[model samples]
Target: MWYEILPSAGIILTFMTIPGFAMYGLNKLVLGNGYRRNMDLRFNRMMYQRDMRLTGDPYKQNGLNAVDG
Candidate 1:
């Protein structure tokens, strides 16, 4: 019983880790890109903020078009 449960637990843990790893890679990419281009961290942050604001509203923004399935 314990041996069977261990495999399931490992699989569950792997699923959680995959997302976490992907997010870490994405964060590194965004910051890394700005760094290589000589842009300051503040500038990078501002750009991300602007994009979020532009896409935040489900009605006024592109949120609806983004989820067409």
Candidate 2:
């Protein structure tokens, strides 16, 4: 019983760790510093100020749409 359970547990752990490490590597390659900052902003882990550089209709933050306003 112990032998069967241990192998199954090890295989499950391997599957889980592989993807976690892969995603960590991908995020390191792609996102660099921005990911942490984005996560922090999302979770309210840090305070942020508006960049105020954008110029457009303030209410139209989303992409272009066909709906009549």
Candidate 3:
């Protein structure tokens, strides 16, 4: 009876552990990619805003003159 229970217990433990590890790995992968994508989006948006500021004529018409002013 003890020997039979040992096999069943091992199977149960294996099933539980394997899925837990798989889910952890998948979670890490998704989060890392999402972070990278977000950073890229932020960078692109900043660049676009900078370009718009540099090329726009409103500041010239308003006589702001300086890029930082």
TM per candidate comes to: 0.41, 0.45, 0.40
Question: Whose TM-score is higher: candidate 1's or candidate 3's?
Answer: 1
Tell me the TM-score of model 3.
0.40
lDDT by residue (tens digit), candidate 2, 1-69: 568799889999999889767876786687552233343454343222222123222222344352335
Worst 10 residues of 3 by lDDT: 31-40
lDDT of 3: 0.58
Best by TM-score: 2
Q: Could you tell me the TM-score of candidate 1?
A: 0.41
Q: Relative to the true structure, how large is the alpha-carbon lDDT of every model?
A: 0.60, 0.50, 0.58
Instruction: Tell me the tens digit of each residue's lDDT in model 3 across 1-69.
Output: 568799889999999899767766775686542122223587776755565587652212233454554
Better of 1 and 3 by lDDT: 1
Residue 43 lDDT in model 1?
Answer: 84
Q: How accurate locally is residue 42 in candidate 2, as Cα lDDT from 0 to 100?
A: 46
The best-first sequence of candidates by lDDT reads 1, 3, 2
TM-score-superior candidate, 2 or 3: 2
Q: Give me candidate 2's TM-score against the actual structure.
A: 0.45
Candidate 1 lDDT over residue span 8-33, tens digit each: 89999999899777866775687542
